[model samples]
Target: MSLARRASAEFAGTALLVAAVVGSGIAAARLSPGDVGLQLLENAFATALALGALILMFGPVSGAHLNPVVSAADWWLGRRAGAGLTVRELAAYAAAQVAGAVTGTVLADLMYGLPAVSWSHTDRIGGNLWLAEVVATAGLVVLVFALARSNRATATPAAVGAYIGAAYWFTSSTSFANPAVTIGRAFTDTFAGIAPASVPGFVAAQLVGGVLAVAALAAWYPQAGRSADAVVVPHLTEETALR
Candidate 1:
């Protein structure tokens, strides 16, 4: 597949993901104002379902990595093996994801009759939350790549969605594992918002988690980590196969 097509898929997928997340948060907050736990559950369910659906729809076109860290991790593995995305493609993917995320937040806000853009006020600043972000991100990265290494690509959407849904309750930070989604969340002051000031820490923690997961994968699956044909991304058409 062409790089442009792949990037487009990433853009669309990420946009839809943020829209679901922000939109669902707004709806949940409005519907269950008195019940924080209920709000979280509703948001988590919507986001988890939407994320799986988006991945299933876009995976065959772009690998459905709606997160920038995921793109970076894939590139990190592919570079040494010369089998995955090149540096330029990685940059393109990251940019598209960020733009899509922002767009999705704006769309969600518009749908809810709010400002197109606004800085979030929900403060998620704390070592505990930071640590939770790290754990959440690391778990996500490990789960994703582990499935790929195990040649269980077809199981990714359901597995990933289920993981995210559970992580919302299991983690203190509500598991904002995706940096692009974090950035998008910063655009709203609703239930899902995370203040912009808190974004850097969350992003840094996520990067650390992704890097650590990749390292672990390399150590555990030495052969799969190095094999060009071992990649189990959803979209690996004949054109994508390294000759």
Candidate 2:
């Protein structure tokens, strides 16, 4: 795919993810204010399900990164192929994701009367919040690497989605799997934003998680080192065999 096409896919996928998160937050706010915990649970489940489906739907066309962190992870894995994105591509994709997420939050706020800041439980700040981000992102990266390395995984996308969905529920941080999404959600002051003060910690945690996942993958698949590059994201080309 051309750069424009890839960017477009990233934009669309990010839009869908943000829409789901914002929409779920709105629904949760209205459906069970007293059961806030349950509301979060529902949101996480929905987010995971949506993410998995989207990856399956878009992975073939544009690799379905939808997150700057994922793109970075792919680069680190040495999977940038002839189609690897440049800094410009990364910036554009990240910008689109943040923009789409902000739009979704604004729309949800208008429709559901979500508080601009205090009322929206969307803020993602605090030590606990940072921990959550780390764990959630770790699971995401680990899963992607594992699936990309194996023939069985490459043959099907459902497992990828299933793993993500499960991790959201299992992880302490309801899984803000995308850094761009996390930053964009912060702007809404809704149930999604991690406190800006806490953003750095969360991001740091995520980076650590990513590194650990990469290390683990390296140990499991010795052949992966054959490529000189560090990151090894999945790629598409007619000439290359699936395995």
Best candidate (score: TM-score): 1
lDDT of each: 0.85, 0.63
Q: Lowest lDDT 10-mer window, candidate 2?
A: 224-233
Candidate 2 residue-wise lDDT, 1-243, digit = tens: 455666677777777777677778768766878787888877777776787777776666567777777666565565434434456666766676667666656665666666543333434556776677777776767666565555444533565556556666776676766667766566556555566655566667777777776677677864432231212235452323243
User: Alpha carbon lDDT of residue 161, candidate 1?
Assistant: 93
206: Cα error in model 1, Å: 0.6
* Local lDDT at 203 for model 2: 67
Point out where model 2 deviates above 4 Å: 79-92, 110-128, 154-157, 224-243
Candidate 1 lDDT over residue span 9-39, tens digit each: 8999999999999999999999999999999
Which is the leading candidate under lDDT?
1
What would the TM-score be for candidate 2 when compared with the true structure? 0.78
